[model samples]
Target: MIDLRIRTARPDEATRVLVFWKEAAEGTSVTDDVDGVTRLISRDPEALILAESDGLLVGSVIAGYDGWRCSLYRLAVLPSHRRRGVSRALLEAAERRFAAVGGRRGDAMVLEANEQAHGAWAAAGYRKENHWRRWVKPFAGPSRPV
Candidate 1:
């Protein structure tokens, strides 16, 4: 096990976080930019959890709780830090956050093609729900006032 410290991300660290994700994360999302990250931190400071070891950012996990559901995303660890209990520690922190927020169940968005991530998630006791599939529709243009 490594000496790990888990905490919520600070707003100014968004750019650094984005760079880290580019190297550590398996895939990209529509909102994988500085603006998106900044918005996330500004809106829900605790949603983005980061793991550090010896003052170095090593892993991250987004534990977003929208009052009713706990949604996990971007569980990433540096390639050099894999198998070092980083992911486990991150997930534990996320789960603790969920419990504190009255979240009933937690669901993660894992890429189907990332077989390596599948094992990590499974080890953390997250199983796939084959009965349901994620459906997404991306907006190509700017958002309009509702």
Candidate 2:
């Protein structure tokens, strides 16, 4: 395995993260922009976890704990770094973050078409909740203020 360092992302690294996602992530997200990522970091600085090797970003995972649910998103590792324990390290870090915050359970948002991700998630001991299906409706404009 490569020499890995895991840490929470800084707000200033949003752009670099986005670029890394494009290369490493399997699918696109509606909130994959600078503003969205910046907002996420601004709101929960510890939610975004990053993995680096020799100062080069190799993986990331969003371990978002919203008081009730622990949601994992954007679990991605560079193709060059796959099977090198990058994803495993990222998930372990994410799970640690969730447990530290009193999260009861953790769930990941994965694409149906990404079969490769299935094995990775399973290897990390995350089973699919076959009974639960994700439902989403994107807003046409800016989100309403809370």
Candidate 3:
């Protein structure tokens, strides 16, 4: 029996989810803050998935579909919860959401520097697109010095 309870994250849980992502997720994104998260929740309520065990958040994944594209992000699992199907559960929920919305494919943003995530993603049946490189342009906002 899978003990983890996977569900859509509630609006009020955005802060808590961000805190968890900081600890377990590979890296942060431009939308990792409270306002950005709130906007995400408001725009697509079911896009953010959370996995909990015994009242504690163990894993999370964002499955965002903007009519034309489906993107996954922030897939994370607590260190103690890794390898216990937490991430799998989150991904499953995300996939289901995408499928229901007629999404033909899903793309995930995994940092190339995070080697540990490579194996996990591969294990989940995701292949790396070697020819593709990400391009970004930061808008004027609270940008972090990296």
| TM-score for all models, in order of appearance | 0.94, 0.94, 0.93
- Residue pairs that clash (backbone atoms under 3 angstroms), model 3: none
Deviation in Å, model 3, residue 37 alpha carbon:
0.6
Worst 10 residues of 2 by lDDT: 137-146
Local error of candidate 2 at 144, Å? 18
Q: Name the lDDT of candidate 2.
A: 0.92
> Model 3, residue 12: displacement in angstroms?
0.8
Q: Per-residue alpha-carbon lDDT of model 2 for 1-146, expressed as tens digits?
A: 79999999999999999999999998777788999899999999999999999999999999999899999999999999999999999999998998898999999998989999999999999999889987766663455321
Predicted candidate 1 versus true structure: per-residue lDDT over 1-146, tens digit per residue: 79999999999999999999999998777787888899999999999999999999999999999888999999999999999999999999999999998988999999999999999999999999999988766774345311
TM-score of 3: 0.93
**Any runs in candidate 2 off by more than 4 Å, and if so which?**
140-146
TM-score of 1: 0.94
